[model samples]
Target: MKRGVSAVFLDRDGTINVDYGYVYEKEKLQFIDGAVQGLKLLQAAGYKLIIVTNQSGIARGFFSIEQMEEFHKNMLDKLAEEGVVISRIYYCPHLNGCECRKPQLKLFYQAQKEFDLDFAKSYVIGDKLRDLALCEKEPVKGYLINAEKKIIAKDKNIIICNNLLSAAKDIVGFKNHESY
Candidate 1:
């Protein structure tokens, strides 16, 4: 089977770390259970791991962009220590209605151009429906974490999982099937 420019776009906050409002301090960052392992698995499976997050805290005056960068630097350093290297990190700092926010495909579009991604072969793993909804154009695959039940999108490409690791498995498995 053949895959396109496959990349795993991850949402931060609840999806990667425990959702604590405007988390800026490095000590405050906590990886959800199995997140590091899951990311390693995806990396081994040849998936480019990219982070697409919405951080309205910048607009809300909770944290500055500099603080966000510091947080991300700490995050990457920690992940690196655990043998996980994120290909890229993209964030939207605007408040609600921002074109780059979740439910909007702006960030995805940017990633597509920057990473040369094929939407059909890409997956967005997030904890919210809006993340899945944003990829409407190409009906990109999606994995929703911590969802009570499977998400029933008008398009059937989205899959819900218990956590980030499970979602990574689902994506890798789906690609494997396509290859076979």
Candidate 2:
């Protein structure tokens, strides 16, 4: 039997880079503070990093798929330069009501099957409540990034953090050590 791998499912727009509304240009790519370091820590801790994003801009005609791909390529290249290796990216280029969009489980199930993921040991991290939808359906823990600390979660499986790095730190049990 193949062992299930643990993974960290991440959101791209507001969670990773600054959300400049319908961002599709490489020139506008900006990593949120501690995002790179957070990913590095997760990767180092043996979590397979995967990005699950909803690129509604494609559906809204704000950007083409090619442009989004180029932006993703540039972002991936930059992350690579920083020694962060993303295992894969699963995106739903659709508007609200798409089965594959965030808060939906289509993409999540696909990743689970492809990776033989261990839900008990995995996590989902993003800046929106929809990003933590996996927690409602699966045993995977969720980290909701709310820098303002405004959103309140009633689910015990969900943890709200100020940013991705804080979530990463909590995931790897480095909540107290802050020298990274």
Best by TM-score: 2
RMSD for each of the candidates:
4.1, 1.3
lDDT of each: 0.83, 0.92
Question: Taking the tens digit of each residue's C-alpha lDDT, what string does model 2 give over 92-160?
Answer: 999987799988989989999998999899999998889889999989899989645667888999988
Model 1 lDDT, residue 33, Cα: 92
* lDDT, model 2, position 79: 100
Q: What would the TM-scores of all predictions be?
A: 0.89, 0.96
lDDT of 1 by residue, 72-178 (tens): 99999999999899988999999887789888888888988888888877788888888776566675788888876544655577776789888877777644423
Q: Give the Cα-based TM-score of candidate 2 against the true structure.
A: 0.96
Best by lDDT: 2
List the lowest-lDDT window of 10 residues for candidate 2: 145-154
